[model samples]
Each structure stands twice: as C-alpha cells, then as structure tokens.
Target: MARAPRIEIARGTTFDQLMLWLDDMLAAFAHLPPDKHGTP
Candidate 1:
C-alpha cells in the first residue's frame, strides 16, 4: 500500500498532539460519503 508523507511540523511534541491531529484528519475523511469515491 502507498504511504502518506511524514511531515514534522513540530519537534519534541507530546504524543497527545500527534494522536489528536491524526484523529481529526480521520474524522474529516469519515464525514465524506463512500459514494464520493464510487465505493458503492
């Protein structure tokens, strides 16, 4: 599988920050209906 780019926006950040960012991004994607990509 292809991988996304790894950007280091901040150095020495806490794990919580990273997890929050990932969760937010995932939620944003989830909001889009599956049909957007013709999945169904």
Candidate 2:
C-alpha cells in the first residue's frame, strides 16, 4: 500500500485567513482576460 502525503498547519491559523487567501486567488484569476492567442 502507498502512503498518503503528510500535511500540517500552523497552530495559530484561523478560518478567516484561509477564506481570505482563497478570495484573493479567485480575484486574480477573474481579472485575467480571455486567452485570444490560440485554441488549447
């Protein structure tokens, strides 16, 4: 059997921080214009 990757979080992290990070990433992606260069 293969072992799963181990994940760890800092003790002081909060839910609000996680949500804020996600929002920031989504906002960045939303601002990008559609790809007019070529068909993928």
Candidate 3:
C-alpha cells in the first residue's frame, strides 16, 4: 500500500516553511507501516 503525502498550504505559508512542513510530514509518514495486515 502507498500512502499519499498530505500537504496543506495556507495564505501566509512561505516556501521554506512549506518545505519544512513537508519534511516533517514525510518523516512522520516514513515512520508508519505501509500496510497493517497480520495473521494470528
């Protein structure tokens, strides 16, 4: 499964700010599992 990146830009958002926000989101996303299927 592929998780789509979620980015929200506000009116006062700057390029650098947006980049940092994306970086944070990507980092957080990377920490999550791609799928959650398991068997007992």
Estimated TM-score per prediction? 0.55, 0.54, 0.51
- Give the winner by TM-score: 1
Candidate 2 off by > 4 Å: 1-11, 36-40
Displacement of the residue 24 alpha carbon in candidate 1, Å: 0.1
- Model 3 scores a C-alpha lDDT of 0.74
In candidate 1, stretches whose alpha carbon ends up further than 4 angstroms from where it belongs are 1-8, 37-40
Between candidates 2 and 3, name the one with more favorable TM-score: 2
Q: Taking the tens digit of each residue's C-alpha lDDT, what string does model 3 give over 1-40?
A: 9986755675778999989988997788777766733322
Task: Summing lDDT over every window of 10 consecutive residues in candidate 3, give the lowest-scoring window.
Answer: 31-40
Worst 10 residues of 1 by lDDT: 31-40
lDDT of each: 0.82, 0.67, 0.74
Q: Where is model 3 more than 4 Å wrong at Cα?
A: 1-8, 34-40
Instruction: For candidate 1, write residues 1-40 as lDDT tens digits.
Output: 8987977757977899889889998888878899875655
Give the per-residue lDDT of model 2 (tens digit) for 1-40: 9987653336666889878878887887776765843324
Q: How many clashing residue pairs are found in candidate 1?
A: 0
Q: Candidate 2 — which pairs collide?
A: none
Q: In model 3, what are the clashing residue pairs, if there are any? A: none
